[model samples]
Target chain A: MIPVCFILIILHAYVNKIAIYDSFVSGAKEGIITVFKIFPTLLGLMLSVAILRESGALNFISKIFLPLAKIIGYPCEAIPLTFMRLVSSSASTSLILDIFKNHGPDSFIGRFVSIMMSCTETIFYTISVYFMSVKITKIRYTLAGALISNFFGIISSLIITKIFFHY
Target chain B: MLSYLWVSMILFGILFSAFSGNLSGITSAVINSSRESVEICLTMLGVLSVWAGMMKIAENSGLIKSLTKKIMPFLKFLFPKLDKESQSIKYIATNIIANMLGLNWAATPAGLKAMQELQKINIDKKIASREMCMFMILNMSSLQIISINIIAFRSQYKSQNPSETIGPGLIATSISTLSAIIFTKVFEKIYFKDGDQK
Candidate 1:
């Protein structure tokens, strides 16, 4: 997919008599600057996430959501992955792997986490990185909207998993 | 808002660790996390530079303009405040297209560029504009036509049918994306309405 797009872009640029090399260099420079701009924000978020994880605060928070998971018929073990999914994809993927190791990928918990992971994103990470690039500190209702959408995603994942993966 | 979240995360993390007598754990986490952040930035540097360059070539070729023109009406409605011919729309469209293609690595650079363009037009430099908020929401709840990573993981785990989750994944993501759009529009109406009334 990427190769196709790259080839098409280069072909189109050549046909249009565009100065591809110079444009690429300039854009690459912009990309570097953007990385620099968001570095601090990323650092802060990662630090907090690390601390939250090591301190067991994340587990505690997930425990609070246990009743909700129970009501929805989700496995208690998968709660951490759902919460971590909002924070970091890599972290959630590791947690999902752990669940798979213990419960088998075809089990209810494994399928649930798989669908949940695929359906949502690392919300806070994306928001901070994108907004920080723009130097926008006040995000308005973006957080609320993203979280609500994620909630719907989680609910839908649970319902769909039950309907499709019923054993 | 971000500041509040950051502060609370740090503060609560410290307090919780202190109360639980896990100060040693928190200390190591803080140290390790900074290193991991640098690693992440380095990885992003490579991906972003390459994709940004490609997008620039596309932009210079006028491909972005043509693409933006094709999607102008929908773009205009979604971002009424942005100028029709602005460079931001092109970046935004590129980001959306990459996201739809499930090319997350390619999407990030375009998303960042789009945000930068949006920031250029921002009346208040520190505050997010309505369009910016909407764009962020859309990006966060990006609808995936195919979740490549999940399929790979499922196959690795030896699932009988690795692709079985694709249908359910698509349906869930679509609902999430639709909800994101609706919530953004609803918030825009409620929040921006007061500004118009004034």
Candidate 2:
């Protein structure tokens, strides 16, 4: 996918008589600057997320949601992934791997988790990185809107997986 | 908002650890994760630079501009307040397209670029504009048509059909993206005073 896109872009630049190398060099410079800008935000986000997970606070919160998840038809085993999905992608991915190991990939829970993980984004991570890029502190209703959409995504994931896998 | 959340997370983590007798776990996590974050950023630097470089070539070659023209109506509907000629529109269109193509690395730089452009037009630098919120919501809804990573993971785990989740994944993500658009518009109406009303 990436190679094809790069080939097409380079071809177009060549055809248009653009200084592809210089343009790339400058853009790469800007990209490095962006990484520096976002570095602190990433550090801060990872610290808090890791601390929460290690201290068992994340599991405590996930436990609290277990009953509600059951009532809503969300698999209990997925509560951890669903909770962590909002904050950290890497953590949630490991959780999914753990689930697959425990339940086997062909099991209902495994397929359900696979679908859920694919359909949801790590909202907090993306928000902090993007907002910090512009130094915006007062994010206002962005969190609210994101959570609303995330709720719908989880619900729809559950329904769709059920319809297709019938598990 | 981030400040409060960050503080709360740290505070709750420490307090919970102390009570749970897991203070040592927190210590290691803090040290390990800080290092891990830097490692992740180093990896991201390479990916971001390549994507940004390729994107620049695409931009200079008028590829992104032409693509933006194709999606202008959709972009306009989502961001009615933004001017058609604004640079952010081009970046926003690129971000969305890259995301739909499952080009995760390409999407972030474009998204960050779009945010920077949006911040330029924002009357208040500290507060997020409506368009910024809408953009973030759309991104968080996960609009990709195929999840290549998940398929690979399924295959690694030896699922009978690794790609079986594709159909359901696409359906679920489309539903989420659609709902994200609707809810964002609804929130805009309720929270931001309409232009006509004023």
lDDT of each: 0.86, 0.89
lDDT of 1 by residue, A51-165 (tens): 8889999889888999977886878998888888999877888998898888888888888877887678899899888987777888889899999999999989899999997
Q: What DockQ does predicted model 2 obtain?
A: 0.81
- Could you give candidate 1's per-residue lDDT for residues B59-164 as a string of tens digits? 8898888887887887888888778778788889988888888888778888887888888878889888887888889888856678888788888988888888
Stretches of candidate 1 exceeding 4 Å from the true structure:
B194-198
For model 1, give the TM-score of chain B.
0.91
Which stretch of 10 consecutive residues in model 1 chain B shows the poorest summed lDDT?
B189-198
Superposed Cα deviation of residue B62, candidate 2 (Å):
0.8
Q: Which lDDT value does model 1 have at A152? A: 92
Pairs in clash, predicted candidate 1: none
Which candidate number maximizes lDDT? 2
- List-wise, what DockQ does each model earn? 0.75, 0.81
lDDT, model 2, position B159 = 87
